[model samples]
Target: MRYVLGIDGGGSKTVCILMNDARQVIGRSEAGSSNYQSIGIAATLKSIQSAICSAVTSTVKIEAICLGLAGVGRAADIENVKVLVQELQNSQLLPIIWDLQPSNIVICNDALIALVGGVGHDVGIVAAVGTGSIIFGRNHQGKTKRVGGWGYILGDEGSAYKIAIAGLQAALKSYDGREISTSLVENFKQHLSLASIEDLIEVIYRQGWKVKEIAALAPIVDLAAASGDEVANKIIDNAAEELIKATSTVINAIFSQNSGLEVITTGSVWRGSSKIHERFTASIINEFPHAKVIFPRFEPAYGAGLLALQRLTR
Candidate 1:
């Protein structure tokens, strides 16, 4: 039976899935970050190679392979990944042999795979909010549009990082009496084990907290909101509104207002206890009533596998 490999590589981790012609997943494995922009090309290649090596268990020929990676939107980034794939094919270190055609090697941004995996198809919207955020959409006509995804400093409006940052800012504001009283101050102090809220300055800057590390604190805001903290709830509301706006933009661009489509929410931000998902879903449905909001039907690696399988037919 013909087999294919699908790889979902991101800033945090890389996952590989081996599947047969019937779309049955046979092997799966994971490795470290493969986003070349964040971890460099060498490390990205190493992670992709490691995941692929660990996933393939038998001598079945891989007909095609799709690598859906983060930070791979630009043409230069795509070419770089192509070179990495070529290097993998040439290397004898893998347990299996390689004779993949160039056309069968699919490379795309992680957002595309997320959309595909979220709804089990390519034509939908994906509002992905993790350490960062990006909105991507594709329609039946093959047209596409994207919003946000500029990273933390520029955009990522409705992301975990943004939520965490807003929570921290609200805490500081409460501390200085600049804003209404909020439990965020105590929550941050307790969550981070800080003696005082001012200690957050050292933890955020002096202690070298990364974006992901800071994003991990978003649950504090979510929990506070769930417990009836007005400031925290406002933060959650703002995040949901921003995502709604971005999703609306995508829907208008490539889809009809009444088009029946799926708007899949992916990543950590949607997992918050603050009912952000319900808020987002309600807003999207109010604006585009036919749009269906959903969680992922399958992991991104599975979508990558589907894309790889599609290459054979194309």
Candidate 2:
């Protein structure tokens, strides 16, 4: 039986799945982050190799492998990933042999895999919002468009980090009587175990909180919004509107207004209790009536496996 390997590597983790010709997943494993741009090439290679080694139980020659990684958009970044994959193929730690041709190796950004896996097809839009946000869409004509994804420094509108920052800002403003009252002040204080709102300065700056750490506090805002906190709800509304705007841009760029397509929502931000997903879906549907908004149908690793399998046919 022909076999293929699919890998979904991102900033947080790497996932590997072994699938056969019949599209049956035989083995699966995970490792640490493999975003070479963030964790460096050597570490990324090691993580990929480790996940591959753990996923392949039997001694089998793999036909193809697809790696969908984060921060791999630019041509230079793609080439760098190609070199990293080449290094992985030459590694001695893997148990199985890869009988890969140049066409058998598929490398792409994580967004594409999310699109493929979310809808069980390659043609759709994926609005991913985590600590960062990006909107990517591909039509049947093979044309694609992307919005946002500039990271936290420049962009990342409608993302969890942005939401958390907004919440914090509102809390401080309310404390100083510069803005309307918000439950966010108490929520943040309780969630972080801070003695006062002023202590947040030390917690954020002095304690060295990273993007992920800050993003984790987004649930506080979400919960407050769910409980009918006006400011928190406004923050959620703004986030939904931003995502809607980004999604609308992608729909208009590559998809006709009447084109029936899926717009998949991926990542932690959509999982919030504030009903942001519903808000986004309603707004998108209201704007582009033919668009179907959805969550992922399968994990990205499965989509990578499908892409790897497609290489054999091509």
Q: Candidate 2's residue-wise lDDT over 88-204, tens digit each?
A: 778877887879998899999999888888888789999999999999999999899999999999999999999999999999999999999999999899888999999999999
Alpha-carbon local distance difference test for all models: 0.92, 0.92
Count of clashing residue pairs in every prediction: 0, 0
The residue-by-residue lDDT of candidate 1 on 71-145, one tens digit each, is 888899889988998888887878776769989999999999999988887899999999899999999988989
TM-score of 1: 0.98
Cα lDDT, model 1, residue 255: 96
| Candidate 1 minimal-lDDT segment of 10 residues | 90-99
The CA lDDT at 206 in model 2 is: 99
Global fold similarity of model 2 (TM-score)? 0.98
- Deviation in Å, model 1, residue 8 alpha carbon: 0.6
